[model samples]
Target: MKESGLPDRYENDAAEKLSPEKQLSPEQQDLKNAIKAFCIAHQHDEHAVFLIEGDAGTGKSIVINSIFNEIQSLSRSSDKSSPFWKTDNYLVVNHPEMMKLYKNISESYPALKKKDFERPTTFINRMHKSGKKADIIFVDEAHLLLTKSDKYNHFKQGNHLEELIKLARITVLVFDEKQVLKFKSCWSQGLLKSLVRGLPCQTYHLKTQFRVHAHQDVLDWIEGFCQKKILPMPQKQTFDLRFFADAQDLYDAIKKENARYRLSRMIATYDYPYRLDGEDHFIREGRFTLRWDRSKPDEKLPWAERPDTIDEVGSVYTVQGFDLNYVGLILGPSVLYDPVTDGIRIDTSRYEDGAAFTGRDGLQDPEGTKERIMLNAINVLMTRAVHGLFIYASDPALRKRLVQMQASRDAA
Candidate 1:
C-alpha cells in the first residue's frame, strides 16, 4: 500500500509543521546564520559544502529544516533581480533507510521508484538528474552515507557526499559523529575537520539538552557522561524497567502517568535478531522490517502486519530521530562494554571479517567497543524522552552498572 493507504499510526509528522514556538537557540542561530551567509556569498558559485555535527537529540533535523525555511523566506524578501531570490530551489535528501518515507514515496509515485529505497545510490542518481543545481542539499542522518570505496559494482567510485554536492550549489550535511554505525564515510567529521583545517567556513555546536526534562536529572547525567567521559549516578537505587517489561505493564504505567508525562506511542525500531511480528508477539511473521547485520546471516527475524496495539521495545536507529515524552530502552545483547576497564567494544565480527568489518573508525578500542556504541545508543535513547527515562539492562554487567549508579545516587 502507498502512504495514503497506510494507517495514520505509522505516518510521521516530524516535518509537517514549523512550530510557532520554533525559535533557534543561540548556538543553532549562529549555525543558521553561517549557512545563510555562505549561500549569500556563494550565490553564483558552482558548489559549497557544509558539515553539521552533533550528538543524538541535538535538534540537527529541525535546524536543517529551519535553514531551508529561512532560505525560502530570504528568497521571497530579496529583490526579484537579486541572485539570492533566484536560488530559492532546495532539496532535502533524507536517508530513506533511516526513515521509511522513501518506500511510501515510491509506492505512491511510481515515476520516482527505486528497487531498494534504502540504498544511498538511488537518491544520488535522482539528485544528479534534477538538472538545476539545488540551492541546498540536506543529507539527514548523514553518518550513514557510504564511503566512495564501499559503493557497489555499479558505483565503485560513488561517493554520496560528492554526488550530492554536485547536485546542489550549496550542500548542507547533517550528521552526528557519535551515531556513525551503518555506513563508513569519507565525508565524516574526521574527513571534514582535516579538509577544512584552515578553511573559513564557520562551525557550531549544540550543547543544550532540549528534548529531555531535567526533572529526574537523568538527562543531565547522561549528557555529562557523553561529553565529559564520566558516568553520573542515576536518581534511583534500581533502574526503572517500567516501559521495557511487557506491553501490558508499560501501557498501564503510561496510562497512570499520562497526566504528568505522556509516553510515545509504539515505535518498533527494526534491528538484528529481533523485529515485531504483527499482532503475534513473536519476531517471525508478516512484518516487513529488515535488519542488516552480517553476523546474523542465518538468522531471520519475523515481521507481520501492524498490530492493533503498540509495542515498547525499539532499535537505537529508529528512535534516534524522534523523541518520546518518557522512554524505556531495552539494550540488546549485541552490545558489550566494561565500566572498570573504560573499555568500549562492539563485536562487529558478525558484520564482517577481522579489521575490514569494523571499518577505519571502528579499529580503535576493539575490546570495550560496545561502550562507545552503547554510549551513543544510550545518548539517543535517554534523550528521546522529555519528562523521564527508564533503562532496562539485559546484560549482567550493564545491569550492574545501572544498579551501582542508582545506589551511588541514593547514598549521596
Candidate 2:
C-alpha cells in the first residue's frame, strides 16, 4: 500500500510553510550577505581570497551559485572594457568526466582557450593567468584537491589549491571534511586554512539542515561528527525504522512494488569481500553488474559511471556526490566491529592498493580505524536517501550497536 517516487512527506509542507530566507538560519543569511559584500569589496582587489568550509548537505553549493549569480549581475553593470571576461569569471573545477559536462563552457564562453578547457587544471590555470583572477572561484567537492604526489600529475601537488587561493581575491571552496574518507597524501585542511589564516576571513558555519524532515532523526545521529554542534541527537522515541530492513528483503520488496527508487542511489557498504573465499565476484539480492575491469587510475573498479538503473547499488566511494529518494545499503565486512571495545574500525590498507575482497569474508584492522571508517561510510550512505534507508548488515554486532545508538538517542 506504499505509493512512491521519492517522499512527499513533509518536504513540500516545509517548503510551503517557510520562505526561502526563512529556510536559512540567521547565520546562513549573514554568511550569504557577507559573501556578497566580500565579492563587491574585493571585486577590485585581485588576489584577495576567501574560503567557505562546511560538512555535507550544508548548502555550500547553493551559496557558491548565489555568489556567482551576484558577480554576474555586478559584472554586467560595470564597464564593458574590463579585461576580465565574465564567462571565465566563474570556474568550476572537478574530476574528469566520461560524459561531456564541460561542453556548455565552450559554447557559452567562446573566448575560452580550446586546449585548456579540456582539463580542469589547464582551464583553471588559464583563467588565473588571464589576470582577472576571477571575481569568484567556486570549487565543489574541494576536499579531493590533490596534493603533489607521483600518482597524480595533472596539477602540482599542494599548489593547486594554493594557486587558486593566489589567483582569486574571493575564492569559496565548499566541501565536507568528513568526505575525506580516504587519507590521501593530498588530504590537508591546513593548506586551505593557511591561505585565509590572518585575512578578514570569518568562518561561517551552516548547521540548519533543510534536507531531512524533523521526524527523520538521522540528522541527529550525524551531528555526532559535524564541526558545528548545532545538531545533536535529540533523545526521542520518534525515530522511524519502518521502511528499513535486511538488504535482501528490502530489494525484493522494492522490486515487487516497482516503486520509484533509483538503482544507482541504492548503495552497499560490504565488509571486505576478499575473505569470502570462493566467489570470484559478489552479488547481492538486487540487479547489478560487478566488473573488475582493471581499476582505472582515478575510477574505482567496483563502481559504475553513473546511475543507469532504477535499482542501482554501489560502493561508498561511488555515491559521494549523489543522492536518492530511497537508499538500500548492504553493509559488508570492510568495517570491523569490536564487541569488547564497542568501537568500529575501517581497514584502509587495501583501499588504494587495489586489493579486491570478493568473498563473504572481510578485512582486518588492529585499531578502531576500520570501525570509524564504517561509521563515517554509514553516515554518508544513510544521508543520501531523502526519504528512506534500508541497511543490510553483515555483522550482527555492528547492527545491534547502530540500533542501540539510535534507540538511546531517541530515548534521551
By lDDT, the best candidate is 1
Off by over 4 Å in 1: 1-21, 73-79, 97-120, 130-132, 149-156, 183-188, 194-200, 215-220, 223-232, 235-272, 275-309, 335-375, 404-412
Query: What is the C-alpha local distance difference test score of candidate 1?
Result: 0.49
TM-score of each: 0.67, 0.67
lDDT of each: 0.49, 0.48
* Distance from true location, Cα of 404 in model 1, Å: 5.3
Candidate 1 colliding pairs, count: 16
Predicted candidate 2 versus true structure: per-residue lDDT over 18-64, tens digit per residue: 22223445656677788777666666765565566665655665565
Question: Residue 278: error of model 2 in Å?
Answer: 23
